[model samples]
Target: SKFGTIYFWRVHYNDSSDHVNETFSFRPVQPGGGGGGMGGA
Candidate 1:
């Protein structure tokens, strides 16, 4: 990864439920930058 680079990531829940629901999220990070989209500016 280099500066100015961008990336994406997400997570899912695989469970057996009558109303199975899951949420996916991603936080891109600037190459050489710290922290994910969690609180990136």
Candidate 2:
């Protein structure tokens, strides 16, 4: 996967029935973006 590139994914399962999950998309952030941090609660 390339950084800053949009990616798409989905889940599928079958248990005596066929089903499809909602499609989702996300973009990869650059290294050391500094956006992930645990704030004081």
Clashing pairs for predicted structure model 1, backbone only:
none
- Over 4 Å off, model 1: 1-29, 35-39
Model 2 CA deviation exceeding 4 Å by range: 1-7, 11-25, 29-41
Q: Give the Å error, residue 7, model 2.
A: 7.5
1-41 in candidate 2: lDDT tens per residue?
A: 32222212222122223322221212223222222321110
The TM-score leader among the candidates is 1
Q: Against the true structure, whose lDDT is highest?
A: 1
| Model 1 lDDT tens row, 1-41 | 42322322222223223222321122234333344432442
| Worst 10 contiguous positions by lDDT, candidate 2 | 32-41
Model 2 residue 4 lDDT score: 22
Model 1, global lDDT: 0.30
Q: Once model 1 is optimally superposed onto the true structure by TM-score, how far is the C-alpha of residue 36 displaced, in angstroms?
A: 0.7
Count of clashes, each model: 0, 0
